[model samples]
Target: MSATDKKQKQAVIAGAGPAGLTGAYELLKHTDIHPVVFEESGEIGGISRTVRYHGNRMDIGGHRFFSKSQRVTDWWDEIMPLQGAPSLDDKLLHTTDKTFAANGPDPEQCDRVMLVRNRISRIFYLHKFFDYPISLKWQTFANMGLVRTIEAGCGYLWSVFFKKPETSLENFYINRFGKPLYRMFFEDYTEKVWGVHPSKLGADWGAQRVKGLSIFAILKDMLKKSFSKKENIKEVETSLIEQFVYPKLGPGQLWETVADEVRQRGGEVITETPVKEIHVENNRVTSVTVENAQGERREVPCDYLLSSLPLKDLVQSIRGIEVPDEVKRIAGDLPYRDFITVGLLMKRLTIDNQTRIKTFANRIPDTWIYIQERDVRIGRLQVFNNWSPYLVKNYENTVWIGLEYFCTEGDAFWQMDDRAFIDMAVGELAKIGIIDPADVLDSVRIKVKKAYPSYFGSYYELDRVKEFLNGIENLWCIGRNGQHRYNNMDHSMMTAMVAVDHIAAGNTDKSAVWSVNTEEEYHESK
Candidate 1:
């Protein structure tokens, strides 16, 4: 289809997130659609926003800009240049006295994103740092000890020779790493993240995330790294990626820029507008009723509608249509994992060695440390300064860390008052030997609902829901929660790209958009 021919249709997008924004950008650039985007939150990025708190900016959860898709990488580079810029000598730079000034350097004005080379992330369990993805190293041996290491090796060999059928998340992990390794490295952390036992969770989530990786592959890759000269092997799985790009301020900068470019191209981007009612007629979405922050309702009519709202919410909110009772029940039952990020600002501190006390300058260099310790409720800890110099208000001796807690909305932890929650988080940090409670200068807590789509027992019902939604000719669901498919940031954007292509070509192929990350092989070469 010609670009000019695509100009006649008006596209209305729900949620100005990565997928919705990418869809709008694609439509505005290739076609003259001039799409209108509506974001329910006050910010542009949905869960991906870089929230500001007391002169500091931090992501809700660490969002690394790594993807195995070249198209997605190119799109990111087009939006925010990740190269051809002078590097900032972060080591030489010191925190200035004006760090806490109200008027700080604005990331939007600079329009910059730092392409961080490679950062270390280790599992902190049993007072030992184990390399993530289970690398063959002395520290791993020292942590597991000789007997446990031998047991792990035998377990892997047994699983390789006698494989079991995969049925649940437990089976998925055990099928790859054997029951021993799965119980040691995955059991507690996985349960903490999902709030469900692995045996009850569906295997689809595991396949989408950690598939194409096994004990054999890890051993083979380790041997090759020690002996071979060839590099950049294509078979390496996504979980084993060592390096990734990140925005200077945070991921919000990228989506915020996309919103600005869309406006510059004569497109409308509205925030704090949530679609409350979807009107369907003749098996097509005709219009939607939205409510603003001021409690004003307005009807937005459009020829084509792209939505990034949760599939359950979208299915339940449609009016003037008769959705199947079974579909509604299944969709509504789809679980979600909420998130809370507690940013703790601490004064200059030091950890004492046996001989003498030393500064925390380079003591812990991990961007984020996975909490494999089961006692604490905190699942992970992100060192904000480690992610980027711009993230922390002061880069010198001061420190900023984000404690991530995974919970369901309205649960005991989620419903805890901010002050109480802050206290609990600080106490936990002290308990975990991360920091002293007295050293904390200030704290801020941010709660995000439906941050992760949980793959529960009802996840298989999503196929039926997708089949039903596919019958609607004018509506397309795209994004992580939009499709309930635990897609990475790149996979989410790729879905929008394909959705735009389908809309422009006047083709009805929801399957094409849905099939993006379902394949077993890497879609892009290094």
Candidate 2:
């Protein structure tokens, strides 16, 4: 094969998640590169897709848009065009001057997404239903005696104050919130989500989410806010410490716009084209094998390959491959729980305290009802209407509840018929008093396998999987499943940006791409 037989220059992105699409678009925008993207789902959005239930639209779960990086915001704002996107004639947000009591705001950060969209969210005191954070203020009265709370409190203070570092999520939180609060707020829900005890789970994910949150931070904030509450105190900005940007529609609208922009920019986005195999030769990823919904397979060759598909699934799909047994074993050991959403549309003209669902707080039905109450291994339920008002259908009004269940491909929950699954969620949720069967108008179910990547103390194993991909030239892995890291959506997209930059430089390092999960640098336009 001479120059005449050489393939036209292009890149292939497997999966339409934020990372894959971002990589494709960044390559097109920043380099003289072209790309073809293959997505397994006919729908563009992955975990962020919007689905309809009884004529009402909802996200996979309750997804919120809150990124500090301007690069992310630039891409998002440009595509979603948040400055003047579509909107409901009657804006859905209700402002509470009492909740957003900050003396002043940066005006700039608070100006873009929310201001133009006319969406608003702030705090609300719910019948004094629960404590602010799992704190000693109430743990002493809840069930544990003063002696116990005092002992745990002392341990927590010593743990953090003495710089006695904790290496796991259980130890980190156990040392901060004390065992009771950790048990109450996080333990049950996480166990339901990961299908494992909190102790077994690594603290890295915990720290990234609520790291540096000490017993002191909670206690100090509680005291200060308590005093300030009588006086009223609130902070509003676009900073991480302030307001979070939200779409008028569900979060999927962001990806939808991004997909449109990619198409308009001459990039090919082929949804429903599941990649079947990655054909390799002499340690190079020569081409990709893909199958459609009807199961016709074809190989597409490209200059580079940026994959956001699952690490294990990608590994298993290699043809004429010669990977080491240890790497294969590591990939096999990587375990993750897939999730399905039972979205229940309700007949309410308005759900009570609708805006209070913004925070991941307890009470107010916005709270995740840990399914530990029943034999069901279901995870938490997200009220989709809580994400944005554009989700509701009409003045008819609605509440879109996402009941999540952890499942393997053919397990009990996974095998359930749609009707059976919805019935089960309704029954279990009603038992918890979070919802009533009578209020439900209609329902729809979406099963997304391998949504949340589980971190099961397998970083070294993940590295082995990484090694296998590293051996394949012109291939980079990005996103949660691609690297098997529990990175948030923003972190995953950032990884894609870095990968595309390297592609522009004619370099392909799988390891370098995986390491882009935490950097905060903005992608300055050249």
Q: Evaluated with TM-score, which candidate comes out highest? A: 1
lDDT of 1: 0.80
Model 1 spans with C-alpha error above 4 angstroms? 1-7, 89-111, 227-233, 348-360, 522-526
Among all candidates shown, the one with the greatest lDDT:
1
Q: Residue 155 CA error for candidate 2 (Å)?
A: 5.9
The lDDT per prediction is: 0.80, 0.64
Question: Could you tell me how far off, in angstroms, the CA of residue 439 lies in candidate 2 after the best superposition?
Answer: 1.9
Error of 2 at 91 (Å): 3.4
Off by over 4 Å in 2: 1-8, 84-90, 95-155, 158-167, 219-242, 349-378, 457-459, 518-526
* lDDT string, candidate 1, 1-526, tens digits: 8865654668889999889999999999887676989889899888888899887888877888877677887888888887555544243133333443234444445556556545567787875667777877777887899888898888877887787778788988888888888888899998988998999888887887888777767777777778866656365566676677888888887888899999998888999999899999998988899999999999988888899999989999888889999889889999999999999988743432221222234346667788888788888888776677677775665788899999999899988999999999998878877789989998999999888999885677888899889998989999988889887778888889999999889898799898888987543211
What is the C-alpha RMSD, rounded to one decimal, of candidate 2?
7.2
Local lDDT at 207 for model 1: 86
Clash pairs, model 2 backbone: 169-203
